[model samples]
Target: MTPQEWVTSGDDQAGDIPSPVGFRILIKPYRLPKFSAGGIALVGESKQYADIAKVAGQVLKMGSECYRGERFSAPWCKIGDYVIFPKHAGQTIEVKRNDGQDPDQYLLVNDDEIRAVVKDPSQIKAYL
Candidate 1:
């Protein structure tokens, strides 16, 4: 959908939802968390992996809505969230493949999404 269409569609319930352009924890089924009912990263996610995943940024990119849709590379982002690139850049981008979460092609993310995760952009070998 065109950005204008997306923005105008909100005309009906604009007051009910806040504009999502900044940093905020995403709600389950992910809408930005707001009020007590809406929360960051859904209330159900366990804290168990929070630490291990922290060493590497962990941002959730929306899984493809359809098989033909182009997967967003660093599409929507949260500060510490990992960005996905279509191709790997060796040491510059540490890619650990996770098995398919769904029947679609798999979702692969760069390790850079972790909280406080930062490396010199120059250090990234080269986008491959």
Candidate 2:
């Protein structure tokens, strides 16, 4: 499903997700398309690499201490906002679903690690 669809679907495994703590933010990374524009299916290894390299995701939850210091006059992003961060910057958390589908992946990143907030996550293409 697209990032927008996934966020709005209300099917996210919220019960299984861990809340962020102390300046950390929980983000649900955007899933890469399984097929390429040329109708070629990506190999398993390629897909995995691309998944790890994905830099854009929707903000799920934030720590109590996030964006609370004098380091900024205002918050750079907020919950439900799509954001970009460094590749492989955060701790990856994978949640297995009961339906036997691929597990959902999330990133727990520092609030300072976010680079920018994206208005449209679908427009951000995977580089891999």
Candidate 3:
């Protein structure tokens, strides 16, 4: 999905999301587009791996102690920023929706795990 669509379509209802603790950050990983640039439909395996190997995500929440340590003079990122992280860096969490739609996936990574912030998440090309 495009960055704008990702933000607008997010499940942000109250009491649905978990607040991060310590120096962790809550991130909602970007879902792979259903079709490639050439309009070829992606297979289920490809979509599943997108969730497993998430590289770009929007910062949803921050722990109380994030960026407060000596290592950081200031916060590297904040909520609403799109960030890049290692494919296998964080713990993956899935939240089931009450409407019985597919559960949403999120990544819980340490604040220091963020490598860079992106101006647009859709421009990121993640390889399988």
Summarize candidate 3's per-residue lDDT along 1-128 as a digit string, tens digits: 56878755746542388899999999988877778878988878886776556588899999999999788999999999999998888898888776677777788999999999998877776676
Question: lDDT values of the candidates?
Answer: 0.27, 0.82, 0.83
Q: Write the per-residue lDDT of candidate 2 for residues 1-128, one digit (tens) a residue.
A: 56678565535543477899999999988866778768889889988887766789999999999988789789989999999988867999987766667777789999999999888776765464
TM-score of each candidate structure, all chains considered together: 0.16, 0.82, 0.86
Model 3 quality (TM-score)? 0.86
Error of 1 at 122 (Å): 30
Model 1 global lDDT (CA atoms, 0 to 1): 0.27
Kindly report which residue pairs in candidate 2 clash with one another: none
Q: Pick the candidate with the highest lDDT.
A: 3
How many clashes in each candidate?
Answer: 9, 0, 0
lDDT score for residue 54 of model 3: 56
- Highest-scoring model, TM-score: 3
